[model samples]
Structures are given as C-alpha cells and as structure tokens.
Target: MTTPRRFDGRRALVTGGSRGIGEGIARRLAAEGAHVIVAGRSLGPAQEVAGEIGGSAVQMDISDAEATMAAVAALGPLDVLVNNAGFDDFAYFTDTAPQQWRALLGTNLEGMFACTHAALPAMQQAGYGRILNIGSEAGRIGSKGNAVYATTKAGIIGFSKSIARENARYGITCNTLAVGPIDTPLTDAARAVPVHGEKMVQAMKDGTLLRRLGTTEEVGAAAAFLCAEEASFVTAECLGVSGGMGISA
Candidate 1:
C-alpha cells in the first residue's frame, strides 16, 4: 500500500497564515507537499510561521486592492488560494459606528474580492484553481450581537456562489466553510470580555450537539479536503465545520 500525495507539485497561497486556523491550514498544505505562500499585514509573525512551516512569506494587507493585486500578481500562478484573512467586530447593529462597519467590510468582504479577482486571471489561463473562503456560522444563523460580522460572512457565501457560477467553465471552484467557535487567539480575546465572555464558552459548548468547541486542526482538515483534487467537482457550496450548530439552517 502507498500513501496518497494529495498536493504534490501544487502551489498554494494562504492569507492570515500566521496563526490559528490559517496557520493550521498552511502547515497541513505544506505537509501534503504544496509549496505554500503565506500573506499577512504583519511581517514578523508571518515570517515566524513561514519559517516554522518551511514556506515562504509575503506581507500585504488584503483589504487594500492595489496591494492585494500586486502581491497576487507577484506570486504568478497558484493552484489553491485560501482566503482566511478576516476580522470580526461583534456588536449590536446599533452599537456599530460607521467607521467600524466600513473597516469590517473593507477587511472581510472587499479584501476577499480583491484577492479572488487577482487570482482569477492566472487560474483561468491555467485551466484549474481552488478557492476556499473562511466564513462563520454567524452568517448561517444571524447572531444577535454579531450583525456586522454576520453580514460580511453572508456576503462571502454570496460572493463564492457567484464565483462558482462564473468560473466553473474555466475549471475554477469557489467555496465557503462557515466555521463554528474554534479555540483561537481571536476567541481568547473575546473570552476576556466581562459581559458575554464566560457565557460564550458555555453557550458554545451547550449550543452544539457535540458539547465542545471545534479546534484549529479540525478546521485545517476540512480546508485541506476542500482544496484537494477530490473536491474538484464541488463548488458554490457553503460547508459548515460547526459541530452541528449550523444544522438549524
């Protein structure tokens, strides 16, 4: 018996690969033999992760169109692009300021659009590509205090579907993985808040059928599968890694 080489000779670009789910995905891809390139707004952390994973690093703010395009162009052709760079501002819609909303949309929605647009030309020319967007379960079922965050994730689903419809003919597939509460640096910060902090952990555990939160490694596995050759036929789909929490939708 022989082990499978899932991504041998493949090239991948993973945004926000410095830590958490993104780091897990980048590490997995590199382990599977993909030449991975990690991009982030910060260089130091990105470099550290890249060094650890034996991958290359590039510093670019995905929210900036020009920067994203330029960075993607420099990467030349890519077999897989993991749009994992995202931020969340959790608040009631009324509490969110104009600037905050703009910033959220800029980083979450516009940033993804720019990277996808920039990667399309090369993918189309090559006749194959895989694009995986990291979304959230908040989008699947609207969150009370996460209105803005939900909106952006919902936007990702729509954008991915549109990409699938338009690019399937070019051998390109786009999909969104709406993740549940995973143990990550971001979540740690959220847990520090006094109001809904402890409640969050309890709710996440009690709300899910699994009675536990998901992990970065689990999400990484799902991501690797989505970007694998086996998933070539799957597109325009929103897959939930949400421990059955998203089953309500």
Candidate 2:
C-alpha cells in the first residue's frame, strides 16, 4: 500500500486526465494527498474526474502550442507534471496519410515540448520538480502497422532524457514510463470492431509474457513512483512497465 501523505501539499497537473490511464494517475495522486489538476481537451469529463477526486480541472489542448503554454502559465506553478496526452493511428507506414502523421505527432511528441517548456521555469525557480512522461512499449519495440505512434513514443524517451540531464542541477527530474497494453479508451475503440479487435486481443496475449493486458491503475502506480520524492535519483530513465513485453526489445 502507498504511504499516506506521500505527496502532501504538492500540486500535480496531468494532461489527458479526464479518463483512462490519465484519470487513473490523477486519482492515485489525489488519493496520496496531491492537489491534482485534471486537464484535458474538454471540460465535462475533466470536471467529472476532478469532482470525484476532489481535485481541479482545466480544459487545455496540449496539441495547441500557444494554448497549452498559456494554460500552464495560468496554473502559476506546479510541483509535478505528467505528460500523458497522446493519440495513435494504426496503419502501415506507406498507407499513413500526412494529416494523420501531423495530428499524431502534434499531440504525442510536440505536446510534451509545449507543456514541459512552460512548466520547467517554475520548477527551476523552486529548485524541485517531478516530470513523469507516459510512453509506450510499442515505441521501444516497434509494432506492426504502428510506425508513427512508435516514432512519437520513442521521441518522448529521448526528449525526457535530455530534459533530465539539463535540469538535474535545478533539482527537476524528468523520466518516461513506457507502458504496456492497457484497457484505455483508445484501445477500447479498437477492440470494438470484431476483426481488428480479435487481432489486437491476440497480439496482447502473445506479446506480453504475462498473457494478459495491464490496468490503468498499474500504469498509475508507476507514474506515481517516478513522480514521488523516492524516485529523485531515478531520472533520465525509461522504465518499462510492459509486463515483460519489452524485455528484449
């Protein structure tokens, strides 16, 4: 069990916190006594989550650079930042459209840059911060027909490492959690269509040594650990919570 008051008095902003893994992370942090802000593209879901967790809500689209930066600035200062906003379009590299690539990259990789850029200064001034990025095992070991998504997640790891190295002196630690297949909104949608859904289900079973998909709360637990004080010495790392999926790759 997590110790009580682990994050007491700290403020954490979790992008995409309205549902799924992001919501799980927000709830976990809030339960641990952090003043969590559930930020998302829309207000209703975010508000629902915030209310349930006794946290706050912000409607901020991380893909929109200016708006995301503005929203972060308005938050004043934050003790923790979880870059969990991302989208994936499954298709072979040759069939992937330019629009899809743009949209995917905009949210997956660029969103990280925008939010981190805005939040870092405050962490620097305060001499402490925890930045946990939600990545994917698909990026570590490229998946079939998921090239764009994999590329973006791989970028997340590299970018976070650089941030950790540069800001370590200021006591701001940045790390990435490359997560495994989880029951998220995105996956749920994919798992709805009978043909592709069955394929996806089988893939999860075959890819993971555990022979089962993971849970959002499991991902949240890893995120909470990396963001907590106990993980101060664990920056610039890509911790794979992939249920043995990325053991070799």
Candidate 3:
C-alpha cells in the first residue's frame, strides 16, 4: 500500500532528529512527502538521518537559548515544529540536585519555550502551522525516580495549551503527545544494567495495559496524525500514545 502525502510541499523541523523517537518522526514525515529538517546537537548523526530521508540537517542545541532562537529563526517559514529534544535522568526528588534540575529544565522546558517562540513568527506570518510537543505519561501519573523530568513534561502540556490559545487566530495548532515507555536507545541503555534493568523494564511493561513497551514507530505514527493538516481542529489537546499505561489512572 502507498502512503498518503498529507504533507506534500510542507516543511517540518524536528529537534533531536538524530535518533530514537525524533528520528522516527522525521522518517515518517519524510515518507509522507514533507521536507524535513533534522536538527540535533551533533552534525554527523543529524546529517545521516537527513541523508536517508532526503532532507536537510541543522545543528541546534535547544538548551542554548540564543543559539536555538537563531537557528530556528533562520529556518524561514516553517509549517511544522516538533519539540522533541529533551533530557532525562532517574532520581528521586529528594536525591536530585539543583544542577540536575537545571539540566533537565533547561533542555526540556526552557528549550521548548525558545524554539516555539522562534518558530511562531514564521508560522504566524504564513497563517498556518502545526506544533507538536513530546510529553510523557510520567507527567500525568508521576514517576518514582523521574520527578524533575516529569515536571518538565507537565510544563509542556500547559505551554502547548497556551500557545494553542494564543495562536489559533493565526491558524496555528499546538498539541502535545503524552508518551509512555518506548523502545529507544535510552531505554536500551537503561535495560542493559544487570538486575535493576530487568526489574525496571518489567515494571514499565506491567504498568501498561498492553504488557509491553511502545515502539518509536508507534510514537511517530501518533505524532504524524496530530501534526497533520487533518488535525487542524485538534489544538490544545494532550493525546496519549502510551499503550494504555495510565488507562485506569
């Protein structure tokens, strides 16, 4: 079966598009006929993904406010912006240090703010845009060791809603995807630890109704729909792509 070119002639920018969920979304968008700009901290990985997808690459470390704003501003008119770049570390609230908090907050929340702010002007000028922020189920249900990370994800929901409300008049839609545990390089590294890794993996699976972690492709598919023109009316919403992880909660 042939894929539909819903984004034909449209341009999209996916931050952290070097690997994992970001890479997945980039590939999906490209497959559906969108010109994707793969942005990441490193140039090589981003270039590789862009090469594979027939797109372009940009070095964008979202945590650097000035650099992020400048890089995004240089993108010209962007039809879609996926705030997928984020940092996460496992630690209880009491155990987390101020430095750790700063790192996560800077990369996840502040970085999103910068990129969105920079992209809004172009979208507003065009009077058409789709913004998809990658959140996490942890934000909604809370995670034992990811307190700061969860906090950042929760902020994303509120941020996206406000952006939607303010930009709807300009034909821009902003939404978030509350993601669940997915099979990504990050998860793989976590699961490589001897005993704790096994237990953590099992717990994540047990939390979901599907009894398994989700895939990057699965996330990409959900993200694609929310960012597509068909979802013009679906602004300020937080869609779960979590394999029913918090269905009861």
Candidate 4:
C-alpha cells in the first residue's frame, strides 16, 4: 500500500500562508508534493513557514492589486491558487465605519479577485487550474456583529461561482471553501472582544454539531481534497469546511 502524493509536479501559492489556516493549507499541499509558495504581508513569518515546509515565500499585501499581481506574476506559472489571505473584526453595522468596511472588502473580497484575475491567465494558457477561496460560515448564516465581514465572504461565493462558470471550459475550477469558526488568530481576536468573547465561543460550540471549534489542520485536509485531481469535476460550488454549521454558503 502507498499513500497518495496528490499534488506532485504542481505549483501552488497560498496567500496569508505565514500562519494559522493559510499555513496549514500550505503545509498540506507541500506535503502532497506541490511546489508551494507561502505568500503574505509579513515577510519573516512567511519565510519561516516556507522554510519549514520546504517551500518559497513572498511578501504580498493582497489588498493592493498592483503589488499582489506583481508578486503573483513573479511566481511565473501556478497550478493552484488558494486565496486564503483575509482579515476581520467584529462590529455592529451601526458602529461600522466606511473605512472599516472598505478595508474589510479590500482584503476579503478585492484581494481574492485580484489574485484570481492574475493567476487565471496562466492557468488558462495551460488549460489547467485550481482556485480555492476561503470563505466563512458567517456569510451563509450571518454573524451578529460581523456583517461587513459576512458581506465580503458572501461576495466571495458569488464571485467564485461566476468565475467558475466563465473558466470551467478552460479546465479551471473555481470553488469556495466556506469555513466555520476555526481556531485561527483572526477568530481568536474576534472572540476576545470585551463584550462577546465568551458568548461567541459558547455559541460556536453550541451551534456546531462537532461541539468544538475546527482546527487549521481540518481546514487544510478539506481544502486539499478539493484541490486534488479527484475533484476535477467539482466547480461553481461552495464546500463547507464547517462542522455541520450550515448546509451551504
């Protein structure tokens, strides 16, 4: 018996791969024999993770379209692109400032768009690609104080579906990995708020059939499966990595 090395001879790039869920995805793909590039805004962490995983690292702030494209271009050709770079903060809509909303959309939605736009040409030229967008369950069910973040995530599903419809003929499959409350730094920060910290954690545990927050490794495994050769026929779909948190996004 032999374990499958699913991503052998492929090139993969994961944004925000320096830590948390992004790092987990990068590690998983690399483990499966993909030539992984861990990209993010923080150089040190990205480099560290890349080194540990025997991959490459780049400093890219996905919100900046020009810089993000330039960075992606430098990687030459990519077989897999994981738009895992994202940020969030918990706040009621009334308290949400215009700048905060813009920034959230910039990172969560705009960044994914920019990266995909840049990567697709190369993928199209080769007639092959796997683009995965990391989404949130908040987008499907809506979170109380995370409307802005939720909006961007919801936007991701629509964006991915549109892209899938447009590019599937070219053998490019675009999908969204709608996730639940994972134990990432972003989630921890959101849950640490002075007002709803405990409440949020309790709610997540109660709502999830798993009865606990998901792990980065769990996210990685599910995402890896989607990117594998076996899932070629899958496109225009939102696969939930949530622990039975929702039916669909």
Top candidate, metric lDDT: 3
Q: Could you give me the TM-score of model 4 versus the true structure?
A: 0.97
Taking the tens digit of each residue's C-alpha lDDT, what string does model 3 give over 116-214?
A: 999999899999999999999888898877899999999999999999999999999999999998999877866775657777778888999898999
Q: Which pairs clash in model 3?
A: none
- Model 3, position 158, has a per-residue lDDT of 93
Error of 2 at 175 (Å): 0.4
Give the Å shift of residue 95 in candidate 4: 0.9
TM-score of 2: 0.97
Task: Estimate the TM-score of every prediction.
Answer: 0.96, 0.97, 0.97, 0.97
> How good is model 1 by TM-score?
0.96
In candidate 2, which residue ranges exceed 4 Å CA deviation? none
Residue range 1-249, candidate 2, lDDT tens digits: 545667999999999999989999999999899999999899999999999999999999988998899899899899999999888777779988899999999999889899999999999999999999989998899887789999999999999999999999999999999998888887876577556776976787689989888888898888889999878899999998878999997
Q: Which ten-residue region of model 2 has the weakest summed lDDT?
A: 189-198
The weakest ten consecutive residues by lDDT in model 3 span: 189-198
Query: Model 3, 6: alpha-carbon shift in Å?
Result: 0.5
lDDT of 1 by residue, 1-249 (tens): 442569899999999998999998998888888888988789888899888877899998987988898889889999999999998776678988999989989999998988898999999999999999999998889877778989999999999999999999999999999998898987786677679877876786676779888999889889989999889889999999989989897
Task: Give the runs in model 3 whose Cα sits over 4 Å from its true position.
Answer: 192-195
How much lDDT does each candidate structure score?
0.89, 0.90, 0.92, 0.90
Single out the weakest 10-residue window by summed lDDT for candidate 4. Answer: 240-249
